[model samples]
Target: MNNVINWFEIYTSDFDRAKKFYTDVFKLELTDLPVSSDRHSQMKYATFPVGVNGIAGALVKMDEVKPGAGGTLVYFDSAEINDELSRVEAAGGRILRPKLNIGDFGFIALVEDSEGNLIGLHSMA
Candidate 1:
């Protein structure tokens, strides 16, 4: 397989707040994604920049989706983990663990998003 993952969704309770947090932390604006069907009237989401290192993802909010920690953790690839970690707190996220070397694989850091989701940051540098 060229890539195992195609897209990902990060669930949030507060769409606006979560959008702002992600935009601020990543330094990129999220384009709103609309739901056309009434069955998903309560759903709202915004996608991250496409083709970002070939990973596509979105911040979603819906009734059935609950945002929290200790679930499936998604790791965001970074050129430098510190660059993103440095802005975590100011963007409303808490750094659970600072960047740590992972030998040949590279470095990784754990953090909690504004919505309380645990996210990992990875970098080769």
Candidate 2:
């Protein structure tokens, strides 16, 4: 009822590659998140840095979770959509859509990350 979404997980087949892509684009290092139980040894993940009150999220890799386009699209907040879009390709991501004005809402751009996930970048400019 509050924020509606509390946490999110971006599934990936390659942990290191995905980590690099995210870190490069966002310019933030992701901390390792351990899978304590043996039952989940096949599963691996790392968490993105978040403020105390900010939403929690992680990059997860597991056999059951297939990373690809479609399904739920996660939008990342950006101060400059065009600047971020410029970094997408060099970071191992392909731009699906160039930065476009959204009128009152500002701007947005879509891209596919290294692991084939369609992620959106939103900005006020």
Query: Top model by TM-score, which number?
Result: 1
Q: Global CA lDDT of candidate 1, please?
A: 0.72
Q: How well does candidate 2 match the true structure in TM-score terms?
A: 0.51
Give me the displacement of residue 89 in model 1, in angstroms: 42
Highest lDDT: which candidate? 1
Q: Which ten residues in a row have the lowest lDDT in candidate 1?
A: 34-43
Give lDDT: candidate 1, residue 78. Answer: 78
Per-residue C-alpha lDDT of model 1 across residues 91-118, encoded as one tens digit per residue: 9999976776644446656788999877
Clashing residue pairs for model 1: none
**Angstrom error at residue 37, model 1:** 3.5
Tell me the tens digit of each residue's lDDT in model 2 across 25-52.
9999898866533342376768787758
